[model samples]
Target: MTILTIPITFDKSHLITIGEKLYSESIELIRELVNNAYDADATSVRVTIAEDEIIVQDNGSGMDEQGLRQYFNIGSTEKRQHNRSPKFNRIRIGEFGIGKFATLAACGRFEVTSRKDNFAATVTFDKEEWEQSNNHWHLPMRLEAPEILKTNGTTVKLNKLYKKFKLDDVERRILEGVPIKAEHFEVYLNNKKISARFLAGQRIPVFEGSEYGIISGELILVSNTNFIVGGPGIEIKVKGVTIKRDLFGMEINFPQLNLLTGEIHADFLPITSDRTGFIKDSPGYHEFNKVMRGVLQRVLHDIKYWQKQKEKKKNRRIVNATVDKVLNALKKNPELASLIGLPVSPEEEKQKTEGEILPKKPRVKRTPAQKRMVSKILGPSAVVARLKIGKKGISCQLDHFGQDSPESYTESNIIYINLDHPLYVREAKNRERLIVNVARLLTQELTLLKNPKNARQAFDTQSKLLKDTLIDTTP
Candidate 1:
């Protein structure tokens, strides 16, 4: 029996289709090229954008003829085999050699010129010409003298561009996509150096060991709300290159998550061909997802704690402002102060003495035991406000008493308001209602001190005092 040999092959158009699909954004090509330079042990990469062309030049270990041949070989395993740079020993950023195809998505023609030791050459690939040449598999190259390159490095010139590239857009892409934080590596766009985006906030350092590798980096809870303009998520990186920004399914409606931004590095995480997502079925990614879920749980807890603290501070301010308004109103109404058994100014006292109708009772001071009981009821966590009424000082304390407790009670100069009262807890949902409820409780306690027997007169006095105190005095 005779056997026939066959080989798998694809059309040139398939190459173009793969490239366009792999690199959906034209700006992504810049990241691919920059990463290529990084893997070459480059110290610096300069990207120049012009009206009609874009140039990427890097000071790295340039390729020789054989190296250039391997570079053009699609899906070459050379980089995967030797995963570190010879010069700087950097963990190579490029895995699948097919990344070079990404250039076709942005330009009609691209040229690569490199010089290493005594070898120097330039290879040009024109998309239009390559497609027209039915079965041609070779590209045009020109040998140049070593002096042409000046030093060892590579320069990629993308000509016949399909679209215009703004410097700001390119810089932003590099900041997010490239690993500018790598040691001894720098990227420049339009002569301006591109640096890693810095977030100012509480940074939680993460260093967890997974079965695949170590998942390490910092997660920042940005303090400035203005800086939270862009999309919110943490960038997942492999081998220093950012693969994608993700929340790992921990996304929620919490506003604090909007301020979340940082990077997580897991070199062993298996990424898809486009590098836009992870291969979820892989064991490496499973472990990574599990670890991230645990980390985010802690982050969520911190965000909740931060939110509570902020609300607590805001509530304290509101309480102080409300108390100040009440004190100011009390000073303006001497009649109200007299009925509440509170001391008034000396001038008001002189006028009241001149027209004395009812006999006055001397103010009674509290004993040490009563003071201790007030302190115990208020508790350490209670919110306290203090103000002076003429020469006497008054203290207002808010604390949680059982629902059966009275709304408020006065002990000497101290008034304790029950926060857990049915009315208070119900009205606390609205700030205005909360202020009114507190004022009503204060009026009840103060009025009871002077006229405990006359309910009708006491209610009338409280209504008058509350009307005056709750007036819109804020200007």
Candidate 2:
């Protein structure tokens, strides 16, 4: 094998292009700058929006001349090597050393003023001058004494804005973007405080680990609403900073999922330079997704069960109303009353018909798979209900007069569902509605059992109503 080394060079325009294309929105530009402030150990950051300029001032340790040199270096790994911010021990969010140019994306010219131990230096970047220069160009730096009396901090001023950003939007984005709730940190936009509010729901702890430290977060199901608000879905936070908000992407497309919101704190996952999303192929990112998918499935199952309970309650009321109406109508009409009778007792009838001639039994030809499935379902004598998926059919059994019967009789509390049946196959696609249908069938059976004398009358009345509805809807 031969050893090879190549020096890579970058065009100034291309370097500028990456920064300009890094963010999709004007709010994202502000977010990146604020994150820079956070990485600098700034406890408080104030953003001021003027008609032609934007100013971000942070009360944190200011940069010295050496730090200034590294800051302007396009791909400097200084922050990665240093790792954490001084004084506060905050995790550094920027490593590529190109975040400063993000401001240049929004403006033609921008300046960084820093003060450290009565020593101050100001650096300015002029896009026009850089464009007119040779391939080699550098941001102009001016070292001087302090002009203003701020002891130790940094201030960034962006002049000649490329695009207008609404102050209110800037505040909203900051609130959603950064981890404002971290102790001792505060963000102010146009003098208004920007803070993070926890979602209103049952808090669920989420934790995972890799070569890095343990990653943790909370998965919550907010109250009342079926969709998440403020910061919907999950936020992927690395070192107490948001890398991607709504991490699940479209929230598994569930309305109740809107009630489901979470914050995933996994700094181990690597992100692209833009920081809008994670590198999907990374081992750490894959593990994070696997864990999150499990959490999402569990939450969805819980939501499904909860929905079923609510629907069951509502349907029970409807069943009771229908039963009452049938009983009342039967009492009012003599002809209907005559049709209502107590169900027959199979055991007593069998004893009385011992001398009668037996009828020929019909032979049923069932496939081996069907026979196996039937055995599996009927094997458990204690099981009151079962739903079996098979070829094109729906057969339900209701417990008749508290008596045990053969599998062939519709006298046990079991429901068999053939998924191959076109109607049920369509309903299966919608899980929520399918659950409701199953519950409705069970509720109807239970309602009949409650008033067995009126069951016939109630069933007849329902059948007539259904027929009338079918006729009315027919073209």
Candidate 3:
């Protein structure tokens, strides 16, 4: 392979945009700066909060003015694959080489101070530079000379913020947005330190059998119960239990983001899990998608997971609001019908749902007899669909009869049985408990029938069917 050389332009115009992204309205700025601090081998990065300003101070090997010019240069290739080294076992988070731009997106003014090899420097830029240049894309305004400190580190101060969101108020939210753990670095909002916590959780069932690759990936604090998958493929581990996983919806960002977030852990990158983990857009991300879909294809998958937590939170509000309306309607009507599944007028639905939800009807208690009857109707062997239970016998149909003392017993499905047809006798090849129960009931009715011959024939046929079912089920 031959080294390819191409002339790349570096001018004042491009420099100003270097840290532009870090100043966005909705974008995450601290995450970008924190990545930079990590790259500099900083084990401790502190976010300092001052009135109307935000500052990020790190104890990493600081940058001299020249180093600052090069490293902070927009689109600088200084972070070539060969020269760069990550200080931790964590995955890579900065890919565009413009993460610092996040500052410009959030604040109207920015400044940096650093010291390296006993040399110190400071650089500051403001909205005036951008406005004065007519947005000509000038290099970031450099004020480096007598650095703020002779110490070995850097401090980034963002001032004149957009104020759409207050730094002092949203520190926790910002901390939550970060993908790393709090133990990695101390985050502060307005001088008050903010502690981080993991997302909520529930029992995540592993694949029934064996896993395909490695388990025990990186840990990410996405949201309570939602951000379990991390590192290579997507794994979750605790003590003796480790789940092997693959493709997360995050792979969808691979094509556009390129390895912006590196494998935060050895278990996560799956160098052994998949060779393509480092290479973007290979089968890795796509494979990740396949795995994600497999885990989330079911409806309740989201009950314990999130494809994109940000989007999920937004959508959850909509669903909750609708449920609240339904509950309110039930409260006003004193009947479930007016609130649930009833085709009342739109005006009625709106009006009836104005009241607050009452305490859930104190859960109607059931007597043992009621429970027994319910067990029979909703038991594992209950015959679903339309069925007539009478002194004559049981006739399978499409409608349920209000029988055996009930509140108009009707259901689209029974508890455990999934028989597609009502009177279909050969339906269950394996001995189904419900089929046997129906046969037994048929036998008892035959014993009491006026005509014994017809009942006897039916019993014989059912007994044979039962025998066949028993054989199949036994095998």
Candidate 4:
């Protein structure tokens, strides 16, 4: 057997490819750089965008010579090993050190200047020059006196930019991608500090613990008229930095979910190499997903409940208006009122107008048993409308009385419309159809009150009443 050594070498183009794939957009490069500062225990990071260059300055624990070497090294494990910042003990945000290479996609050349302890140095990496040097991997470095930097920090300057950076876009990306909410940490774009985006809506808080770690955040059900900054979706963050905005396969499931916007943090979830998504196959990711699913289920339930309440309120308004129209029609046509045993003669009308007081009938109150029976027949969320025609009062209630129950029935002066009736449930999907169904039910019940033994007469009377109430009153 012959033993031979095999060497694995990487081409300069590979760096460009990786950077383009990882960053994708020029704005993403800024996010990676800002996060690097955060991992270095930076309390303040200032990003400046100019016509020809972009600069990122941080007041973090800057790197020494060896630290600079580690910074340039691809896929360095130093941050993963430490896992926390030396001064602040903040959970490190940078896991794959290749984040630095993201600059290659946005600029032709970039320079890093750092000051730490007694050392101060600047390293410049010119993309064109580096690619031309076949096997040479070292970058140009200049030693500067410690006085060059007034404080221990790092400044990265990207020159000969491949793309222009917009101030607004940079500020937004940093606000979403960096851990600005961390204690003592602040990010600025062109001297203006970046703060978390505010959403005005109902906030649903979430906190869950799994074997991996704890997931915590608030989900917002944005107001219908309010414009969401980034549209609908919950931002998923790991280690306080947002990875992506996701709805977790719920965008199409519920129409009300289009108004959802918020963020969730799960520091223990394993992320993909680009840091744009989680590793779905990992145990940590599964646990995080489980927790998020439960949270979203609750959100769905709340949204449905709110929608049902709103619909009920709207329907009640419609029902009241319909009832008023029915009463007005009955008053205009004494013949129809007489069919329901509420005759309003001309003499009685004159007496009423002359202020002749009529004896008031005592109102009847329901006993507990009767109230329970009403609840059972008309559901708890039933909408009730009451009106007086001539000397008689009538009560109309809309509720679910089961599909097997009559479309409508009268109990004393009360008329109940069965929402669960097959015809009613079908017509309820349309506003106009629902109004017609309710008017038809009310006409049937009122006409049948007097002509209980005559089905043909009741049907004719109901048809006339329905036409008068719906056609004459519907505007």
- lDDT at 7, model 3: 97
Estimate TM-scores for all models: 0.81, 0.65, 0.45, 0.78
**Strongest candidate by lDDT:** 4
User: 230 in model 2: Cα distance from truth in Å?
Assistant: 6.6
User: Residue 247 of model 4: what lDDT?
Assistant: 80
lDDT of 2 by residue, 179-208 (tens): 687777899988978877655667778776
| Residue pairs in clash, model 2 | 226-259, 227-258, 227-259, 228-258
lDDT of 3 by residue, 418-465 (tens): 223343224333334434444433323222221225767656544543
Full-model lDDT for every candidate: 0.79, 0.63, 0.45, 0.80
Best by TM-score: 1
Regions of model 3 farther than 4 Å from truth: 1-27, 80-90, 130-151, 167-169, 182-184, 198-200, 205-283, 297-475
Worst 10 residues of 4 by lDDT: 352-361
> Mind giving the per-residue lDDT tens digits that candidate 4 earns over 250-304?
7787767778888898998888767788889998888777778788888998887
Ranking by TM-score: 1, 4, 2, 3
lDDT of 1 by residue, 223-294 (tens): 765774346678788887778877876676555576777889999998877677789899888889999989
How far is 374's C-alpha from truth in model 2 (Å)?
22
Clashing pairs in 4: none
Clashes of 2: 4
Query: In candidate 2, residue 282 scores what lDDT?
Result: 84
